[model samples]
Target: MSDEPAGLVRPDRRRPEPLWHQAEMALRDLIDQGEWAPGLQIPNEDRLCEMLGISRITLRHALRNLEEAGMLRREHGRGTFVRSATMVAGVRGLTSFTDEMQTLAVSPGTRLLLAQVISATREIAEALEIAEGDSVVQLRRLRLGNGQPIGIQTTHLPSARVPGLFEAASDVTSLYRWLKDNAGIVPVKAKEVYRVGAVAAGDASDLELPVGTPAFEVERITFDQRSPFEFAVSTMRADRYEIRSTLYV
Candidate 1:
């Protein structure tokens, strides 16, 4: 579950200690206890100041400390939000993009941005377990929902397996689902790693950000009965999305 902090408090003038520090401790407690879970947005600055009865500097000091500790993250002009240390439930389950969009009540669409075949570089070879100079199919697409560019997905499939997949999958909906329905490849288990980083220069323009704006990174490797079919890297806008995970005791 996501945490929504509504306990912004500006203290009365009669209080001996400052309100910001007090509010900071309260927020820290909230985070530690899973009250304000990671990737959830906290109240904005003005609301926080008014609720906590503290100056901007004091509130910022507490916030900066928490952010540095990896419990939170801040963005310019967007707002402050929780940063999950690990992938949540939604991210863990292996599912198609089509299914995810349906769950979120958004219309999913893809623009076939690029389709190319190139020799595998050392990095790609290592990741895909193919020899260097072996050809691979690289598909680049802009993933959209509700007519907004939410993310970019670049998938690399070994040419050995899917020689003509790039051309055949010209912006077709839901590669995973399509594969399962047509080619009889269904993923059983997949590994996904999440990281916080800036968008790359090449993708900056496509992502509609300055040269190096913050974004959510997901690098994943998926396997089907046939082979490791999907290795992709995704970047999402930090402001528009949040993280959720279930922790078992």
Candidate 2:
């Protein structure tokens, strides 16, 4: 809860790396050491600039990069605050929700909302690459972290591919874990798309957000070996979630 800016070393003029990158690294070190805990307001921009012995523009560049990396949050006229470290997913790994939460030291829980066998609609069929009207097992769940609602997840699987899923739905906590243990299916890769969306009434209720609130809509298709086996859509509270991606040339 210290309001003062942590002491920062001035960027080395002789270093080949950019000054902004150096400043960013210095701030990152402070955060990693817990000098600036989550939700703690940082010093004003002028103070930070003076403390780092850098210009305002250079300080802004470093702050912007940290914000994009989910290490800080800036509010209009309210200054900046340290953000809680969040779970990060990259393109190289297919991780389950439980695993992600566990890695972040957050307890994960799931509440089964709906579990039934339904005829695949046009949308579900297209996503799963199945014929319309074919039987599909639909599972709706409320995802929780540390006993707080985080998101709503709905999954569709071809009924023939996962027979008896409905019968074991009540005992399931992690869909990926169940798939591996019961069906011997392991997700090796996935393709996901994300967009900002207005929360629907049902999803809003599950996420404990007001209807029409902004949320993150994530649609994913998971593959076991080379075959697509699961299609899932998750609506997460934008305030509590951050999406991350790594790019390569």
Candidate 3:
């Protein structure tokens, strides 16, 4: 996990902006700057209220925003603590966890949640530029920042390119990063489809989403010039999340 503080570029209590949201962003910046490292319990609500010059309700709103973003977790009596930063490196850039997280100034790291060899189904084979039933390496990841869950990414790659990827699946934080380091398959272009949906039961169960909440879904097909590299499915929390892109149209 490697990310610097998210500085408050915009004040929330401005003319049209919301105070609580602005305060939340400012606090997030403080946490990202290493002012509050992960696992280190945050100051009590009363202390936070004094520091931010906000009421308890306002402070709580900001805190709740962080909790939903998966950047902070609140335990019964333990208090709020830092969560890992997740990347939203949009279709505008060709990047991996290591690249994007570093840009955001966060310590981006990965933990392999699953690695397996499976016969490529029609959908996957089509996406990966391989024939049906071809061998594919399924790599699943739980991306962390400092130490909290920020995203869940799963990839399917042709085994030929990443031989025994399943065997290499120990904490490969960035598959694209892995590609550059291991195969030199630097991506130049990628096609992405963005959608919004509720966190599935299984996803919610794993990510600890608050019973019912929406998560953004990003499906991507990475390419290196003429060939496809892999197929990916990623789910990220909507709060504190966005795909900033430039549009010419």
Q: Which scores greater on TM-score, model 2 or model 3?
A: 2
**Residue 128's lDDT in candidate 2:** 84
lDDT of 2 by residue, 153-232 (tens): 99999988887788999999888888888888899889989999988987877788899999889999998885788999
TM-scores vs. true structure, each candidate: 0.62, 0.69, 0.64
| Poorly placed runs, candidate 2 (over 4 Å) | 1-38, 42-80, 84-92
lDDT (0 to 1) per candidate:
0.72, 0.83, 0.74
TM-score comparison, 1 vs 3, better candidate:
3
lDDT for 161 in candidate 3 is 83
List residue ranges in candidate 3 displaced over 4 A. 1-91, 246-249
Please give the RMSD to the true structure for each candidate, in Å: 11.5, 6.2, 10.1
TM-score (C-alpha, index-matched) for candidate 2: 0.69
Q: Give each model's clash number.
A: 11, 0, 13
In candidate 3 the C-alpha lDDT for residue 185 amounts to 82
